[model samples]
Target: MKELKHLNKYFKKYWFKLLIGVLITIIARIFSLIMPSYVNKSIQAVEEFMADTISLSEAKGMLLQYILVIVGAALLSALFTFLMRQTIINVSRYIEYDLKNEVFDHYQLLSLNFYKKNRIGDLMNRISEDINQVRMYAGPAIMYGIQTLTLFVCLVPLMFIKAPTLAAYTLLPLPILSVLIYQISKVIHKRSTKVQEFLSTLSTFTQESFSGISVIKAYGIEPRINAELRVLANQGKDTSMSLAKVNAWFFPLMILLIGISNIFVVYIGGRQYINGDIESIGVIAEFILYVNMLTWPVAIVGWLTSIIQTAEASQKRINEFLKAEPSIKNEVLQPTVIHGDIEFKNVTFTYEDTDITALKDISFKVKAGQTVAILGKTGSGKSTILDLVARLYDVTSGEVLIDGVPVQKLNLNSLRNSIGAVPQDAFLFSDTIENNIRFGNENASHDEIVAVAKKAVVHKNIEGFAKKYDTILGERGITLSGGQKQRVSIARALLKNPQIYLFDDCLSAVDTETEEEILNNLKKVSESKTTLIVSHRVSSAKNADKIIVLDNGKIIQEGSHQELNAVDGYYKELYLNQLSGKE
Candidate 1:
């Protein structure tokens, strides 16, 4: 409900239209009520004239007036219907725009941990399906509810005027109907909530399966994946059927109550006509018209109840997401420009739901414009250091500082924009090469992009493609080879020309010759910027200003490659192995 209050802005924008629509609807209902009275008066006039109790000329005049009234009421109804539809539909569109913008903004502000915890498909469902449910209630349900209330107010007065006794009898079943609607609505709300949850689970499963289809096929586990998918599909179907069942029972029960009310109107009004207590056939006929008007309003009670319940469930989910607090938030003050000097001081970090520390009591410093190589065995927290430096996650204890300012105090955008990273598994969108490069520098010139691609040694390979820079890569760059994709990613990062660069095994996919070319390019680029390279190859770390060896989340040795090779330790052992392999 608190999340729904955010819609007040849209409400303010459309308030006048809604007011006009409601006013018109009330006027229309009032005019419609007059038609029944006219029918009764016209019939009584004709009968009196035929019985010679009134003159024919007077009856003719009365008939003309009644005909005009009926035509005017029909016109009013049509006009109000148009106005209500136009206003409510536009309101729905405005609310949709607001909800989408809010969701997108929230996504951007959320921490990396949030993304790690929630699946992409689940987020999509919140933005699409859940938002649509809210729109349905806001627009059509609210509009119809207003229409019903107007009809009830206008028709009840007329009913009392025509035959107060019959009107009183007709209302007897309404309280029972109200209780039934309330109970059914509660059930619908509970079931609809479950349905939305199941839909999210189904969407998550579908997205995961499709994204990992390559792995599934490679491992020959398609049958296992399919079975898992079937389970999720059945769960979704069960929840949907449960909701449909609630509607099925609720609608019929509503109709039965309405039918009984209609029958009572006919039975009691007929006796009044026979006993002469009611004046004429016209009176009974008008009473029936009023009763017919009551029918839709009664039916609408069920529809409105269901709509509100569904909307409430959707709002609850949306509210939970909106209320989620990001683990990382911006600093109160903007930080000064960074000079790329980074230090890790007695830092310790452990991921959520884990006991082992990823990095413990780690201390290191890299000066500006120096190349540092982090040599480590797998799972030695090399990549975790880069992630921490980028503030993807906060340290569990101690501090990481950038240019003398604590990383937490620095402006997040300024901190991240100052660093460029090429990860182990490089990813690209299904877009042109030019567009992908432009992601690093949106306004980069074609020549500038080509220059950076040359530095990454990828330009020649790109030129071999039919469309070259304009070629659209397949989804996740699947159309390109692993080395080509990695080089493209490198080219993109190089284009940024950041103060600090991180290469996390980015050259692993390239051949020895291509890897040497990229390393040569990096050697030239590293002269005026801070660079950190995480690699397993001894040859790659040989030229670094400083090389640090890590094992089991702790640094085992730190020195130049020649100095580490001088010692009979892990570095020397690695060098011997590589040299022996070459021999």
Candidate 2:
């Protein structure tokens, strides 16, 4: 209930409709209860006519009036019942929609490390299956609960008012049912929670298997995968069956208790009538109808308890993430723009998950409109530098300054909006070619997309596809070749035309000739913009304004390409090896 307080704001928005639904529910139950009383009066009129206390036509007239009133009450009851669902159940749907959007928006604001620690399948299950369980509480459980309460309030008093002794006997078994429900409810709560957890685990396993199906097939591990899935399936089956066994106990126990109540009404009420304590057999018939009225609401008590327990379990999971504060907070209260002057001042960054320091006291500077290239081996912290400039992660010990302001002091959205970064791995959505490229600049025209694609040396490949720019890509853009995917990512970055361009080894997949063409095109287009390129190839950095080489996490060399190549150091050795291979 404490976690579910998050929905109080949503409930306030629909309070009027909920209030109306409650009023309608009371009216509907009142009309339905009228029928049992009239049924008794109609029987009394028939008996008076048989005893010659009234004319046949007079008795017939009384009976007809009673029957007509009973039918009219039933009709009104059904009509209001329909209106009750419209107001109450519809509010639940509206709340469900609002909750999903709230969760998804929070997911977007979280820092990158949050994604690294969580599985996509677990995230998907919480948003989807878990919310569905909560919706069951919001809609059906609440609706039926109101119906049950209304029935009990109206039916109980009427039964006792007609005959107090018979009413007491009929309700004798009810206390036992309440005790049974309490004991069963405790076990149901424990089982329902376990079922929800297992669902998340199963969803995570299935999602991972589908995403990595290519790897499974390539390694010929189909048999292994199948065997593992069978184990999971069996476990899921057993877990569900355990829950089903508890739920299966609900209806039978309710019906057996209801049967006992009915026997008490008929057997006990008949003796009272024979002994002249009661006036008519019609009274006995009315009691039977009252007992039947209690049937459905009582049956649903167990089902409703199960729903509330399941909803509470799911809300606990949702609240865990909803309450999580983002590690990265925007320090700037107002909008701030960048002029693309970037500097790393003795920055040291260690990954929290692996406890590996990716950068150690690394210092570098690139003035506005200057091009700097970083050359390094794998794990040399090149990509980490680009991520810092993009502010994906904050520095551990030092400041990353942008346009003479500490990166944290700048407006987070404004700072990110000013930079275009192409990561080492080119990830494209399962969308059309035009749509994927337009992701960087949604309003870019067709000619603008074509222009950037030409600059990245991928226009010719797009022309060869049957649908050209309209061609749909497979997952992660597997439909394109490795080089084509990299170029498309470059085109996307180019389309943004940001003040700062961070291209992290984005041209590595292209042939040297193609790479040379793209570089010349980049030089022409990026004349007055800050550019940082991370690459292993010497040719990619040969014509830069400045070059910085990293070994392990610290910078080993920094100078112009000509100056570095002239010396006998790490840069010169790499240049000689690459030049020999080209020759």
Query: Measured by TM-score, how close is model 2 to the native structure?
Result: 0.96
lDDT of 2 by residue, 1-583 (tens): 6666777898898898888988888888889999988999988888888889899999989999999999999999999999988988898889899889999999998888989998888888889877888888887887889889998887888778879999999878776765676568768888878877888888888888887888999999999989998998898898889878987777678789989998998898999999877788888888888888877777668667877877888988987888877888888889897899999999999988788999999998999999999999999999999999999998899999998889999999998899988888899999999999998899999999999999999999999999999999998998998899999999999999999999999988999999999999999878899999999999999999999999899999999999999999999999999999999
RMSD per candidate (Å) reads 2.8, 1.8
TM-score for candidate 1, please give it: 0.91
Best by TM-score: 2
Off by over 4 Å in 1: 1-35, 38-69, 333-335
State every prediction's TM-score relative to the real structure: 0.91, 0.96
Candidate 1, after superposition: displacement of residue 31 in Å? 4.8
Q: Give the per-residue Cα lDDT of candidate 1 at 391.
A: 90
Root-mean-square deviation of Cα positions for candidate 1 versus the true structure, in angstroms: 2.8
